[model samples]
Target: MSSRYSFGGDEHVFVEVSEEMSLEAFFKALSMTNAVRDAEISGVTEICPANASFQIKFDPDVIRPDDLLTELRRLEDIADRAEATLDTRIVEIPVYYRDPWTHETLMRFRERHQDPESTDIEFAARINGYSSVDDFIAAHSGAPWFVSMVGFVSGLPFLYQMVDRARQIQVPKYLRPRTDTPRLTVGYGGCFSCIYSVRGAGGYQMFGITPMPIYDPDQETSYLREFMVFFRPGDIVKWRQIDRDEYDGCTADVQAGRYTPRIRDVVFSLEDFNRDIDGTNARLEETLYAD
Candidate 1:
């Protein structure tokens, strides 16, 4: 389907890839936007890729809006004919589930939650048809997730699971936004997962917390030294459940500026993935953990 184009006055143009968010929509938008970037079109100042769409900022004085739209359509046609692959990294993240920090924060915000009586995990497990929280954890940590987009509190990534839609773990956000959320709180809302990069206001249901910092302006930590923002769109992530002891240890390493998240560079083929989801994901796993 062709994209829906809307102009944000004379300076910006928004292209909606699909009415609803899906992997297909994301890929189409990404491919087209990337093509635009590689082409280095004049007057195009910024390209922002979201889950199912992209917005481009441009100077109308250099290129007319209708001309820019025509170029985008032409570029997308070329991009569609090309193979779909991405150079991205697979990262292993350590998550301490059922931690005390998020627990305390949730309790304070009970009135805003769907179930005030149960913890976030318990609520999620119940709604997702898991008999136990342990089973829920197994299901969650069992699969890899794709970083669909990076936004919502700077450097915070929106993750979509690599499983089929029927197998997705879905959860509702809080009834009302919380004034406080622990930094690095692993959260889920609808079908997407996220790690809170900063502590402020949020509505996503908190599941766990990672000791890692996804964003830091100071770049004081070893991991953030390379890039202040740790996550990027198209990055794949695997969750490794950790105990309190391990969490503390990792936190110590982070504070001492000695910790680095385990990462592996991998080329992802969307064609192969769409053809055989399970096989493609398995191959990605092998590439990520190859010894």
Candidate 2:
């Protein structure tokens, strides 16, 4: 589909690459945004990429709105012709599924769930055609997910799995929003997976908890020293399942200022992934974990 452009008042321009979410659409958005950023377009204050769209904040005084729209159209054409490649990083996120903390929280909010008797994972597993919660967790942690958007909360990443549409896991949010969700809580809603960056009100189905922090105000860790937010749109994330012992160990490491997440720089290609989903994902994980 052709790109659709719209004006957001006089300061922002919104572009929709596709009505639905797909890697191709995201790549297109990323490509166009990167090109505009590289050009150092005058008056462009911020370039934000969403699930399948992007928006640019600018100063109309420095560059006329019509002129900026023309430039964006030009950039969109350039992006269409450019190679389908993304310069991004793969980050390993450790999660302890069905942990006691989140389990208790879910139990307390059971009446707000579709199945008050069953745990969040149990209900999710049953609906997804899995026989047990373990099977559901296995399916979830089996594939890597791409960060399509980072919002709703500071540093919270909305992740879409790098798999065929049929294979994607889908879940519904709580019947009522929870008053409190623990920081680093792993949640799922619709077709996206999310990690809560802070303890706050949430409606997503709570599944697990991560030991490391995704958002730090003080920027204490080495990883957070450069930026308070760890994730950006287009970053690949693999959720690694860990036991309570390992979770505690990682937590201790974080407290001691010694925890560093597993990360690797790799060029993601939409063409290659479209051709071979499993092969591309294997290569991505291997590259990220390689010694």
Candidate 3:
């Protein structure tokens, strides 16, 4: 079970947990190690019952495979009993997807999907598990949480598992896409779980747009550093919804440069664009939390 951990060409650790192994047990085994040694460990779980496997990756420069192996070997039992803890944080972002113009804008987006339905504010709140937009944003407080494999679009991160209530978002029926949709708009009929970072046509029903810049090329590191979003693997996310005024103000702050682009802190290089996986784009996970 421990033999599957490998290193990429650039020295990134890649470990796969097969169907036979238990994920809970694997994470328990991983938890015995020091947090510092767990540098940049993030990967996805292939949860098919017949083919369950978790792919883990880490920075090789900070940790050696031999050291990792040794640590795992020596502390395997301890790890198996320890709990994996995630460091979570909350970020407040203001966005304006609820503008009155959204009705028309959404209509345009709906044209791309067959029988695309209009969404009411109450429905949006319900899907996000909030009674109101204010309540929605307020609940999304704490450390930034990252989840795996939300669909990606235009180099923007689409995070998942907003909440159990949010998991029921419906897939669009239409097969064709609209090219005129703005990138900042929320797609999938106000699913609010996904976001588009740039201006482009998409098939997902968009609910609104956040004023914040989803990516920055000038920073030393951007959120897209390795195409991951705000949170690392296994982190939890709390989502909230806010009113139009709050969203407008947030955009104003970003436009005025008061709010730094969080994506810049993790993005590595624009030069690496050529090496990025094709069609795997990202959008910043937009939760309407104010603080």
| lDDT for each candidate structure | 0.90, 0.92, 0.42
Best by lDDT: 2
- Candidate 1 TM-score, C-alpha based: 0.96
Report, for all candidates in order, the number of backbone clashes.
Answer: 0, 0, 35
Q: Could you give candidate 1's per-residue lDDT for residues 198-276 as a string of tens digits?
A: 9989999998999998899998989888788998888999998999999999999999988978899999888788889
| Span of 10 residues, lowest total lDDT, candidate 3 | 44-53
Model 3 residue 262 distance off true place after TM-score fit, in angstroms: 11
Give lDDT: candidate 2, residue 210: 95
For residue 203, what is the lDDT in candidate 2? 94
Give per-model CA RMSD.
1.3, 1.4, 11.9
Candidate 2 local lDDT, 1-291, one digit each (tens): 579999999999999999988878888888888999998999999999888999999999999999999999999888889999888999999999999999989988888989998888888899999988888898899889999988887989999999998888999999999998989999999988999999999999989999989999899876798999999998999999999999999999999989989999999988899999999999998998899
C-alpha RMSD in Å of predicted model 2 compared with the true structure: 1.4
List ranges where model 3 is wrong by over 4 Å: 1-82, 95-97, 100-105, 116-146, 150-155, 162-174, 189-192, 220-236, 260-291
TM-score of each: 0.96, 0.96, 0.49
Model 2 residue runs over 4 Å out of place are none
